[model samples]
Target: MIMNPIPTQSSEIRVTPIPRMTQGGRWRVEAMRSYTSDLLLWFTRGQGRITVSGRTRGFGAHNAVFIPAGTMHGFEITSQVFGTAAFFPRSLNLAFPQEPLHLRIRDAAPQGDLTLILENLQRELDGDRPKKERAAENYAGLFSVWLDRAKLQYPQNERKSEKADQLVARYSTMIEEQFRSGRTVSEYAQALGITPTHLSRICNKSCGRSASALLADRILYEARRLLRETKLPVQQVAAQLGFTSAAYFSRAFQNHTGKTPSDFRRGA
Candidate 1:
């Protein structure tokens, strides 16, 4: 599950065409992995199933899938597929769906508009036109608008409480800023003016996972990324992740990922 960093044509965004298949038709066997950037995949002609953060769903033509940064995901294409993939940093500040999304573009106008945006985005990346970066950003903004419309159209059941949602979002943002500091869940809860138990309950209700689990997931993802993408040793990676000892870090990583840090690095 070692994913190489995606190359970008622009510093802010990347648009790449997805091939129908690899030369040997063996792209399906790649292990599940994740990215440090947000991903939006548009399938114009395809049949496939995608797994995101342990949930699997089927998709077909005219579907757009979103995988937020650091979420583990993979795909299997059953038939010939053609698509465009957009990768952008989370700092772009687009209010995309918080969770993974599989949006179907059924209506003709929206689908055609989406296709045109993708085409122009590709052209902006490929051609040496003036102010191409700004052009790409504008197209990316339009694409985000399209996705927001799709999310609005998608039906929902009972929604989580607004208060709970706000708490979870704030907590998540704090984690991103402070995960490297070895802060405890209780400390984070105290900073947010809530008890640790209440924070856990809110996280569970909002995302079906505990607050501690979310914190540990972020730490482990960073560990894996460091192990795979850098030459840092296991001990160094452990220390960088705020572990007290290399041995403790190894045990924690094994418990969460079923692989020792050294083994995982070697495999990668």
Candidate 2:
């Protein structure tokens, strides 16, 4: 008599882009690590348990959940699995809900609206990427409408913080995110309706640094990351850090750390 061995299923995942709603990528369960960058996940089909932000839930078909940026989490992948994930910038929450905490729908599934959003998202795969604002507006518009159907209470939200603090934190996260995109302090300040000085003051009081400092830090952090992690050469690294010339970036790096980028990378 011959006996059959049961095969153990590998619970991994991949992310497919659905147009402007997401920039494309794939993720496996093991790839879910403590990422400083934010991520969004949707399970189109499968059954498993996921622990996000420390809460575990059984998930499967017609069930969806979201994990905010900076959440330390992992999940169990079992049986036949399929899904899509979007790598959302932290700035996106400023335009809508706060992610894992906010618990906005990932896909409606059995719910009619969410299913439509997923369908529309799937259709996104075939076309050219739309302007981010248009795509964002579409997602925000449809999702907010669904949120309107939510019976959550505002009393808890009001008790969390005043609108000012909320806006400041959200915008700070946004600035840290998009500083490389060429927008300036004046632009961000004007958009936030405060003088640049006041915005700086708010940032200093809340985060112990000026808004400008935060932006520079993001740039420098990326510089250090590229310097140590990738094979891009010195001049290219300088350009990637938003410097026009390697000489200028060297000076800036020295000013910050008293060391040249080459020395830093060697030691790092």
lDDT of each: 0.74, 0.53
Q: What tens-digit string does per-residue lDDT give for candidate 2 at 67-96?
A: 555454456554465565544344334343
Tens-digit lDDT string for candidate 1 (165-209): 778767876776777788999999999999999999987866566
Per-model clash counts, in order, read 0, 2
Candidate 2: residue pairs that collide: 15-26, 108-114
TM-score per candidate, in order? 0.66, 0.44
> How high a TM-score does candidate 2 get?
0.44
* Model 2 misplaced stretches (Cα beyond 4 Å): 1-67, 70-159
C-alpha RMSD in Å of predicted model 2 compared with the true structure: 13.3
Question: lDDT value for candidate 2?
Answer: 0.53
Cα deviation at 190, candidate 2, in Å, is: 2.5
Error of 1 at 5 (Å): 3.0
Q: In candidate 1, where is summed lDDT lowest over 10 consecutive residues?
A: 21-30
